[model samples]
Target: MGMQPMEWTENALIKRSTDFGKLCALHERDPEAASAKLETMMQTVRTMLEHVGVADVNNVEQASIITEILTKKFRAMHDREPETTEETNLIRSFAQIHARVQQAHAALQRQNGDKDTSNKSPNAPHDNAVPPAA
Candidate 1:
């Protein structure tokens, strides 16, 4: 079977988080160039979402909040901001939520695997019966 809904959500979240980290790394390596690239990519993502007809204002709001928090953290880390206590705390909160979501996804995957294995026929081919790699 394909990935469950929760698995897909977790994987997407992880990928996005990694993408953000890569963006931050690029910024560290070259701030001016990275900022321009980040801005372009952000606009691209927004346009793509709009094209897909997912006109959810909540999603847009969430994206804006996340972007603000990310920008503040980046500025603070680079000493562009003298202090960023609130932004730092927001980042920490986001990290905690990310971890919890990941953990829940893992648990769901494990539960699904166990259920499938228990339902498998003994005569089924072992390789064919195994869950596909994530």
Candidate 2:
């Protein structure tokens, strides 16, 4: 058999989820702060893209392109082998921010989904709901 995947402790996962929730709360309370953080990240990515050029860059095409680039750069810089304390902390912070932003986005998506679901007609049939098929 192949090796089993490593398991995370329940407490660890709960702590992480809680931290992500807190980040979501922060985003909700002051979206400007999140926007500033993202803008800073985008500025960093733009600087890197200028350095490397768009042709040389592999992954900078998505909405979260800046976050993706920063995460990649951060990992490449620090996660070679054993990590120093500073490197570990940097990675942790980077990961937390990323996770928090993603969680906030997920929360937004869920809210949007709920709104859409609530707005839909309960009696509508799937195929005949809208105008005739073209």
TM-score per candidate = 0.34, 0.36
Give candidate 2 misplaced runs (Cα > 4 Å): 1-63, 114-134
lDDT of each: 0.48, 0.44
Any idea what lDDT model 2 has? Answer: 0.44
As a TM-score, model 1 comes out at 0.34
lDDT of 1: 0.48
Candidate 1 lDDT over residue span 1-134, tens digit each? 34222212345545555666677788658877876766665554444334323233344334444444554555555665334564455355445543433333334434455465655445334453336589
Residue 53 lDDT in model 1? 30
Q: What value does the lDDT take at residue 101 in candidate 1?
A: 34
Cα lDDT for residue 124, model 1?
33
Please report the candidate that would top TM-score against the real structure: 2
| Candidate that scores best on lDDT | 1
